[model samples]
Target: MLCFRFCPVPRLELVLLCLVLGAARSCALELNLTNSEKATCLYAKWQMNFTIHYETTNKTYKTATISDHDNVTYNGSICDDDHNVSKIAVQFGSGFSWIVNFTKQEPNYFIDSISFSYNTEDNITFPGAKDKGIVTVHYSEKVSIPLNDIFRCSSLLTYEENHVVQHYWDVLVQAFVQNGTVSRKEFLCTKDKGSTTVAPIIHTTVPSPTTTPTPKEKPQVGNYSVSNGNTTCLLATMGLQLNITQDKIASVININPNSTGFTGSCQPQTAQLRLNSSIIKYLDFVFAVKNENRFYLKEVNASIYLANGSVFSIANNNLSYWDAPLGSSYMCNKEQTLSVSGTFQINTFNLKVQPFNVTEGKYSTAQECSLDDDTILIPIIVGAGLSGLIIVIVIAYLIGRRKSYAGYQTL
Candidate 1:
């Protein structure tokens, strides 16, 4: 007896092959261009109407408008054969529509070309017909006309009805202008094809005016200075002086007169506004250093000491504002002094002061000295106790010796 055998193909492989074939078959629509014969007049004015049709079986749709460049449209129709159609309508999202109108004229001696552009609208459907509840569909197309091709054939003037056509026209116009082939002139004199008249001259007459000279405003005076010790000082408004002292080696003082009060003990090299006090109404103290007696005051070196017993130093690399460096340093016992000097309003002076240092050794010596005194008193107390104990032992020994002598006598 003979047996028969059968084999089945996988469903997934078959579906994939079908999908690839469908994708390969799907291609963009090709645009058709109409050619025209050359004419002797070089330029002829003619009115033409063009219609663009958008069709889709999708029912959830609305009407929209077209692009505004080159072509005028109304109700989905552009210029009529006699240029009677004043507008054209275009559609957008969910079938929205729009219309616009404009006119163009060409010189009789030169060949003229025309083109149109349109705006595209995408249609999307949600809660799809099948198990999947959403679907997106995109529809985008454009039409363009090259300057050389435009002039070559009058029939080829119409461009594709798409959104990007105007951009293409803009590029074409720029290229034409740059290549010196075309020049755009404003038709100011010719409102219509009519008679000519003499151009009018516009003139302005000046009346004899009274002269009340106003004095120029003087420059507001202000002065600001930051020291190497990170101290900041500001003098503003009728001798209003403010001084900021560093409490610690790394203490940065900011004096902002415009603000409520001073801000201090900030990190060095921090790009924070320390002192904002201005000598004048508008002049405020900015972090900057000045030079005097060949000394450079750098602003970036401004720093302050932290209360946590840690030294905070400011980076002094950037010196755009001032020549002096403002920063802080940590020291054991040595007084941390910040020396700040600058010339403000032709007055030069240097300010110096010690900042607060919270290091461990700051009060250690005094504390150690106090502890040593306590130890010295303890030694004296111990010596007195030992003497009292020796006195007691001597008394006891004397009593025992007396008792022994008495016993010997009794014997």
Candidate 2:
């Protein structure tokens, strides 16, 4: 009851792709570039601490910092290899970038120091600032990155008003075929470790037991969020098998639950329920009811195959949530958007899977449904009417007899 909700090829897909490409090619993940080591769990959460020091040429400056930590959920690391990471890089937009340089020691990666920077003439603006000024930022932070299974990628992490609430997990692919590969392309190396070529490596803050307090103000943390135009809280596609044409199969779903990026408990969302089977042809329906955060498809059209390969399509009868009496409506509010991609569902049979995002106008042959409530309702109404009439006639006859008997008693 708690797992069915999900979306389409929107910005979410693009973001995942970017994460894949950037993670595969990012310089900060030196292990990814190392040929001897294999990189797995490339797509996982990285707990980042960002400190932005914005300074101008004329000596005007301010610093702001933010921690990706939310007290409850722990964002994990990058590798499964027992060998610790020697380098960690967190790249910001076009300008700002951060890296923690470390050396690969006997068993663990020894962190030497953390480095980060942002430099721009006029782009870095704070809470209150005049129009034009050059700004330079040197931010340093330490964080942990978690590891994920080979097929799964923790694509998005959302918090409501900066509070970490659970039950909003939406992992994109539960199983991956690894359609792409990561390879180390090129390298620029220096013979001497201390040569001027490694010039950028500099001394950052190495906190000792006792250090004098500095009066510098803490940097302001900025807002970070991920959402679509409709503000879907969380979505995932689970147990989905695709690209089967010859055999009967199970189906796919697109659950677009509505929320401002916050999902918890039973909040049902709009969905495209589809089930495709070689024996059952195809089935598709689009719905936009209220949003619920629980997982599992409330109702799906299914097909039952007999011993002799005979098949029957499931309709209103098999559905617990979608069960409506014969001729009665679906009893749930439908989605208003006429979007072609707004809804989807699946089926069970000899294994075939297909998708239809086109607008559904009327029920086709595959959508033919049946319910026995009306078949029994007609007989019940007639029997009830006849029973009521018979009782009324018997009461009238008894009254007439009483009137007739009153005259005899008077005589």
Candidate 3:
């Protein structure tokens, strides 16, 4: 009896200990890159300081920097030849993610871009920014690394701004690289060095532009998927542009699946893709099975947060957009828009959607949207007419050439 009582207590303590350890685990900034042959190409150790300059309600500028050691967790990493790009991502704070992309250029691979996205409803806040949703900043120039040498650029800072807030990156990067067999050599970017080392490469800080910066454009199209355990359930590729109205003012938002947070339920006959925005409070897109073998977008739900801390809710459940048969996808390459309400609208461009019944983690077939059929048919008819005319002209030219050859007794 004593063994039974004490054994349960120890098992409970073990379970609680595991939970504590799991919660205490944090992410490291170390990353690796490999080529298509499964050979190591690059090794990087990096940490970043993101500082945001925002104007408070009293018209005073204030700055905040993200703490790297506090609440940062590594999301995932990918290196593929499909785009010749390598990526590693981390989620910090509540709803903020930072992704770094690297690209190969002949004998060297360099940092291609860096993207930072944050939800307004989360920990990070841009006080005076006119634009909302996921805010992304891209580096126009490359940060390169040489072969067999470690590129250390600890002094280079990048500055960018949107309509309201200014953003800055103070990144410390040390990457070892090579052309064939990857190796590491110490090369510094700092001005102070000992007598034994070679001359260091210097980098200047990027200056702020003089002109007023336009709002950053969000990604409108991407291929996105979701899985349960080891099985794939949802696969879709679509372009999404949203128009939202508040207080008679309209704002356009671009939806990039990579930067947006995704959560949904996938059942046998029903599936959903809920995209929650850090800028917007809550957003949802619903797709359901209909007509036995067909599925269509059935609803849209959103709760827009206002400036005064109030919520504005909008939804439309009577939508039947983008209907396609099971095991196939619906495609429309033309531009189209669907009106959900007086205050909400969704626009699509070069669209392709498959929300249910995917097999082998891929779309099995395609069913073009009816609205796009007429647009495609007109181009096909015009091309056929032009081809027929060209054929007639070619035949006439051939006959003329034969007659001339016969008259001259030429073979």
Among the numbered candidates, top TM-score falls to 3
Candidates' C-alpha lDDT: 0.25, 0.28, 0.56
User: For candidate 2, what's the RMSD?
Assistant: 24.9
lDDT of 1 by residue, 1-411 (tens): 112122212210000001111211211111111112111111111122222323224422122222211211123322221332222233333333333332323221111323343333333321221222122222232223232222211111222232111111101111112122233431221211122322111001111132211222222222322223434322112122222222211111222222212223323323222321111112222333224211122342323211221222333443342222222221112211222322111111122211212132121111121222357888889999999999999999999999999999999
TM-scores for every predicted model: 0.15, 0.21, 0.42
Candidate 3 global CA lDDT score:
0.56
Which parts of model 3 have CA positions greater than 4 angstroms off? Answer: 1-218, 306-310, 374-411
RMSD value for candidate 3: 19.9
- lDDT (tens digit, per residue) of candidate 2 on 8-54: 12111111112222211211111222112232322322233333333
- The alpha-carbon lDDT assigned to residue 321 of candidate 2 equals 37
Q: State, as a TM-score between 0 and 1, how close model 1 is to the true structure.
A: 0.15
- The residue-level lDDT of candidate 3 at 391 comes to 100
Residue 308 lDDT in candidate 3: 21
Q: Candidate 3 lDDT, tens digit per residue, 187-236?
A: 55442232122221111221123221123354468776777768778876
Tell me model 1's lDDT, rounded to 2 decimals: 0.25
